[model samples]
Target: MTTIVPPKERECERCGRTDTWNDDTGTWAVVERDGDRLSGDPFCLHEWDINGAYNPLEEGA
Candidate 1:
């Protein structure tokens, strides 16, 4: 048996900005922060921390 699960949301460890996966649009949409919607902040570089700890795809698929 095989199963695939993708991350639903990801947050910047630096600025705390968050985004939610939108299956309908096939994109990550910015989630509102404190009632205000924003794409990002001036301080955050927006670089994804994808390293050995994270895998976007299945291991052997």
Candidate 2:
């Protein structure tokens, strides 16, 4: 039997904002806003490179 695992949640290091990977949309959606910065206009302005990796997936055979 094979088991499928969900992607891990990602949080911003600067403001504590949280997001989750949406497999249906193939994108990340904001689930929680920690402060004004993340809650204000342009929801996600943080640099992802500095945020580090959030999810891990196995390569298909």
Candidate 3:
């Protein structure tokens, strides 16, 4: 027996924008925030919808 799982909704870590996998389009689409199904470019850095500011700190910095 094998189990198959559907792709889970993905949210942008920077803006909290959400996206769902579209089987018809065969691509991950932005389904929330300003873009909303327009494209995958959800985080513009200049504008973020989620809490907290954009930190440029690198790992171990």
Candidate 4:
């Protein structure tokens, strides 16, 4: 069961939008006009919310 805790929100470095925690990929990624994908950066710390939209990050964006 996914724990519903008050996730800490953060702004993405690239997009500068608020993003919560992602459980599928286990990371924090914000929604962008492009798509959804792991930034390959360290952002996920388990203190995240799944309310944000999910998309795969494009090859180059």
Candidate 5:
């Protein structure tokens, strides 16, 4: 049996509320505000692990 890595339940930087992705849309629940800052966005986990986007929390976890 193959094990899938579950998406991390992360707290939004802006709202501080926890959210996750809706596998169907493949998008984050919250919108990213910072232009300069990268990672930890709504779907940062997916981006970092699956899509290869800017993910700052990669090292800490």
Candidate 6:
């Protein structure tokens, strides 16, 4: 058996935009804000902070 681990969430620190991983559609959707689902307001240069300290998929892969 193989275990599939999916990324749950990610946020842009520069613009305070958060996105949740959608397993059904296999895509990242923007989080709900102000009673509406927003998309592409302030296009920011996404810089993911993936560093040495963060390791989620390091177990028995």
Candidate 2's residue-wise lDDT over 1-61, tens digit each? 9966555556565556666677887767777544433332355455432334334442221
Query: What C-alpha lDDT do the candidate models reach, one value each?
Result: 0.65, 0.52, 0.47, 0.47, 0.45, 0.60
RMSD (CA, Å), candidate 3 to true, equals: 9.9
Error of 4 at 48 (Å): 12
Q: Rank the candidates by TM-score, best first.
A: 1, 6, 2, 3, 5, 4
Q: Sort every candidate by lDDT, greatest first.
A: 1, 6, 2, 3, 4, 5
Per-residue accuracy of model 4 over 1-61 as CA lDDT, tens digit each: 8965645445544433556557777665564446754343454332222344433342322
Off by over 4 Å in 5: 1-8, 13-15, 30-61
- Tens digits of per-residue lDDT, candidate 3, 18-50, equal 655677766555665553453435344423233
Error of 4 at 3 (Å): 9.5
- Per-residue C-alpha lDDT of model 1 across residues 1-61, encoded as one tens digit per residue: 8865667777766676777778887777788878887666757776544342554442332
Clashes counted in candidate 4 amount to: 7
Candidate 5, position 30, lDDT: 44
Model 4 lDDT-worst window of ten: 52-61
Steric clashes per prediction: 0, 0, 0, 7, 0, 0
Report model 3's TM-score to 2 decimal places. 0.42
Q: What is the C-alpha lDDT profile of model 6 across 1-61, one tens digit per residue?
A: 9965655776766666677767787666788888766443476775434442444443332
In terms of lDDT, the best-performing candidate is 1
Q: Tell me model 3's lDDT, rounded to 2 decimals.
A: 0.47
TM-scores for every predicted model: 0.59, 0.44, 0.42, 0.29, 0.31, 0.56
Off by over 4 Å in 4: 1-8, 11-16, 33-61
